[model samples]
Target chain A: MIEFKNVTKTFGKTTALDHICLSIPKGKIIGILGPNGSGKSTLLKMVVGLNKANSGSLSIDGKNPSQETRNSISYLPEIDYLYSWMTIQQAADFVKSFYRDWDEAKYKELLSFLELKPSMVIKKISKGMRAKAKLLLSFSRNADLILLDEPLSGIDILTRDRIIETIIKDYRAGDQTILITTHEIREIEGILDEVFFIRNGKVALNGDVETLREEHGASLIEIMKEVYSNENSQW
Target chain B: MKIANGSMLSTLYKKDIMSMKLENIIMLVGILLGHLYFAYKASTGWHPGTIPFTSSTIFSIVLFVILLGTFSSIRREWNNNTIYLIMSLPVGGKTIFLSKLLTILTQLVVFGGLSVLLGILSSLHFLGSDLLVEGLGFISKYQLIQELLKFVTLLFIGVIQIIFVAFFSSIVGSLFKRFSGFITFAIFVISNVIIGRIYTEMLKLFMHLHIESTRQSISSEFFLAQVGLMLVISIIFFFLTSAVYDKKVEL
Candidate 1:
């Protein structure tokens, strides 16, 4: 379980997260839905311990975000983070050295399923293939928590579908928690168990996907539109 | 299977070393070629002064490389966006820091030793075997060996001190969100100034204590004391740098 109590993060004069309080239960797929600059990435970065909170506290599995918590969390940033000189196989081996929960068999399966050869250099691969490579490294770990930031961004439609499929295929239901932040909501709407709608660094709305759908009497796309429309009108 | 801590450190060392593979190769080839060119000149003309002058110039270039590399190593991670991967790793900051420091030390030993060897060979070629022996005729062989040992020890400490200061300054600079390069430069200059002041004080104290001793014994004692003090100071900088790296750096 991950808990945030009055957590606020700021960069210069811009507030990234505003006194936010939320608890993410274990073993669920949660979508942190927000447009660019709405603090979606900052929230994910906070959970992964990449960014620090200015106030309040954050805990992962009852422990504060630190080196110990990092062992249980696998994070895939929105940008390309892999070393360009490393091939897919070398990257995997490098990650495996630092993570005890790395699963070699799962890594191999994902490699073939994603159609990425181990010998393919990261620098030489296409952007779509690089996205798959990132997914391969993240899913290969049996981490308690997996955070994917903008996984679908810049990816081709076919590759995006494959990435979503790979997420579903590799996910261990009821044993792992996954948090994903992305703008391509329609493609991943079917897989999210819960969704948090953030606006201007605040949690505008959050609830179970099915419950939110029923209460709003519309699909997530419609709800998203209505929520943003209301904010725009108010402004 | 779980990787032991030793295995993890080894992996880190290998990765860091591999990052500098091209730089190391270039350094090696460049130094060798430079030595060969100088050796050829010495063979033709036999200028006694040229070998020492060239060797010192080579030393200056190597020192410049070390200084430049200390900053570039840290900056490259940010430029490539690989800091994200490195920062997310489960290892502690000290481990990350130790691997990089070990890589630089390895380079220093390998290239420094090679240059020293080549310099000695060139000296022999220019001075000839009998002249080299006669040049050291005043001192006993044991005393000459002792003096060489002292010089090497002092060189090692001095280089480590400089590297530590640069490393510490770079890590401190990384903690900021703006103008990190300027900040690092400022910190480097300020810290060196502070250390230089303290070293001067220590030097005065050593001179006062060894005033009654013979010049040879006094200098020997002073050199040993300087090495001991620098080692302690370097260790302090290591801890300070690693602490910042572990707790403060953000990507």
Candidate 2:
């Protein structure tokens, strides 16, 4: 479980997150929906301890997201994380040595499933392959929580479905929590149990995905469009 | 369960070595080849005079290798955004810093040991030649060993100094983010100029103070003491770098 208590993060004069409070429970797929600059990335970064909140506190499993907390969490940033010079096998070896809970069998299976060559340098891989590599690394970890920022962002529809299916298959029931952030609402709608819509640096709506869809009499995509339009109407 | 700190440290040290990509082996081979070439050249009438084949060359090569190894190790991690992965590990920042320092020291020691062995072999090869027999008689092996030991120690300290400077530059670059490359270049140029000017001024001051004494009056002990002081300063800088790196926010 993760909790953010009255968290506020500011960059110069602009506020990235403003006095937001949220509690995320375990064993659920949570989707963070927001437009560009809606502070989705900032919130996730704070939860992972990459970015410090200007004023409040964030805790994962009752401990602050320090190095110790990080051990229990896997994070996949939108940007490429694999080193340009490291081959896939070398990267795997390096990462495996660092984590005590590293599952070598799972890692090898994921590599094969992703069709990644062991000796291939990450820089030479296509973007889709790189994304798969990142996914493999994150999913292979026996972590209690996983934070994936825009995992489906530049992939084709079929690849996106494959990625989603991979994640669903690998999901460790009742032991792992996953928080995915993206603007592509429909792509992940069926997979997400809970949805949080962020607007103007605050959580505008947060609830069960099915409940919200039924209440609004629309799909997640239509609801998101309506929410963004409503927020912009005030501006 | 409480983890034994020693095992954790050893694990981190091993990881750091692997991350360095066998830099130590490459340096050892490079140093051996360089010294062997120089030794062969000196013995084959390439240079008629006695070659300055001292332990200092070995120490210099080891120091250079360590400097390059440490810089590339840390710099590559930062450039590749691997610092996030490293910092996010279960280890504390202090442990990470100590592991890096240990890795750098171990690399330098390995390279230094290899260079010494190669240097001795090269010296023996040179001494076997008839042309160098006459010159070799004048050099005292005991004195050479002592001087070499002192120079090796000094080189170790110098490598530490270079590591501190590189670490400082990395922290600065990380802070500046987008302009870090340009800032690091400018800092490199300016720092060299500043150091050169300071060295000249210090030499001038020392000369003025000892105007009455002859050059012969100044002993090797004086130079050794100066190097010792530099080693102490380098240690302080190393600690400073570790402190900054531990607390500084990653951009």
Best by lDDT: 1
Off by over 4 Å in 2: A12-14, A108-112, A115-121, A230-235, B1-45, B50-69, B110-151, B178-239
- Each prediction's DockQ? 0.69, 0.33
| Native-referenced DockQ of model 2 | 0.33
Q: Write candidate 1's Cα lDDT for A101-124 as tens digits.
A: 999999988888999999999999
Q: What level of docking quality does candidate 2 show? A: acceptable
TM-score per candidate: 0.94, 0.77
Q: A5, model 1: CA deviation in Å?
A: 0.5
- Residue A70 in model 2: shift from native, Å? 1.1
Per-residue accuracy of model 1 over B1-251 as CA lDDT, tens digit each: 34577777888888888877888888899889988888778778868668978976886687678678877777778889988998888877778777878888888888877887787777777767786677677456436667778777877887788788888888888878689899999999998899889889988886677644355543666777788888988888888888888777777
Docking class of 1: medium
TM-score of 2: 0.77
- What global local distance difference test value does model 2 have? 0.74
- Which window of ten consecutive residues has the lowest lDDT sum in model 2 chain B? B211-220
